[model samples]
Target: MAKEVSCPNCGKPVEWSEQSQWRPFCSERCRLIDLGEWLNESHRIADPTDAPSEDPPPSDDLSTPH
Candidate 1:
């Protein structure tokens, strides 16, 4: 039997098998909606470090004059 999973966006039951093109999503619409959320910054992956990313300090080593 194929494993069943709930759609991440719609809570619809989905079959975890080769036929499930969208896999975790119920349909293309649901997938697009989820994509839109990420694109709009409504969804974000939790940073494991739990700290805002910062740019590395500029290197002080001066390059040899070309």
Candidate 2:
């Protein structure tokens, strides 16, 4: 028996096989929906660093004669 995985978009059972074109997604509609979400910033990777520092470090060029 082949292993199955739930579709990320619709939670449908999908066979993890070569015949499964979308693999993790059930169909093209589900795949496109997921793509749209990513494009719209609905999904984002968490950043480990803190928010950007307001004050930037002093540049070496500023100290040199220009």
Candidate 3:
């Protein structure tokens, strides 16, 4: 069985899995808003592991040089 969660953007309820096309965010627009939040660092999840993250983590190289 799939789980249900509230929409991170609008607080609306959403099923984790559904065939209605809109998923995770309830619609493509919501999905894009979530992505924008992620890009803007409005959302962040702390690592649950006790051990420290690996040294010299790989860079995503998404930044542009000034």
Candidate 4:
């Protein structure tokens, strides 16, 4: 027997097998919904930690000729 997994979008039970076209998502609607969320920036991956940077700006000597 194949193991079952829940759909990420609608929380529906999905079979983890070759027969399941949408393995993570239950249906096309759910898949599209998830895509829309990503496109709209509703879903984001969190960073491990926030660090401040103190890098200096690049010199503009190359842009100006003597």
lDDT of 3 by residue, 1-66 (tens): 777877777778788875636666777888888888787563345434545667774466556444
Q: Which runs in model 2 stand beyond 4 Å of their true positions?
A: 42-66
Instruction: Report the C-alpha lDDT of model 4 over 1-66, residue by residue, as the tens digit.
Output: 999999999899999898889888888899898889887563344432344566676667676666
Ordered from best to worst lDDT, the candidate numbers read 2, 1, 4, 3
Q: Kindly list the per-residue Cα lDDT of model 2 for residues 1-66, writing each as its tens digit.
A: 989999999899999898999988988899999989887663344443444657766677667666
Lowest lDDT block of 10, candidate 3: 42-51
Instruction: Judge candidate 4 at residue 2 and give its lDDT.
Output: 93
Model 1 bad stretches (over 4 Å): 42-66
Clashes of each: 0, 0, 0, 0
How close to the true structure is residue 66 of candidate 4, measured as C-alpha lDDT?
66
Please tell me which model should have the higher lDDT, number 3 or number 4: 4
Deviation from native of the Cα of residue 61 in model 4, angstroms: 36
Predicted candidate 3, C-alpha RMSD: 14.0
lDDT of 2: 0.82
Error of 1 at 51 (Å): 20
State the local distance difference test value for candidate 1: 0.82
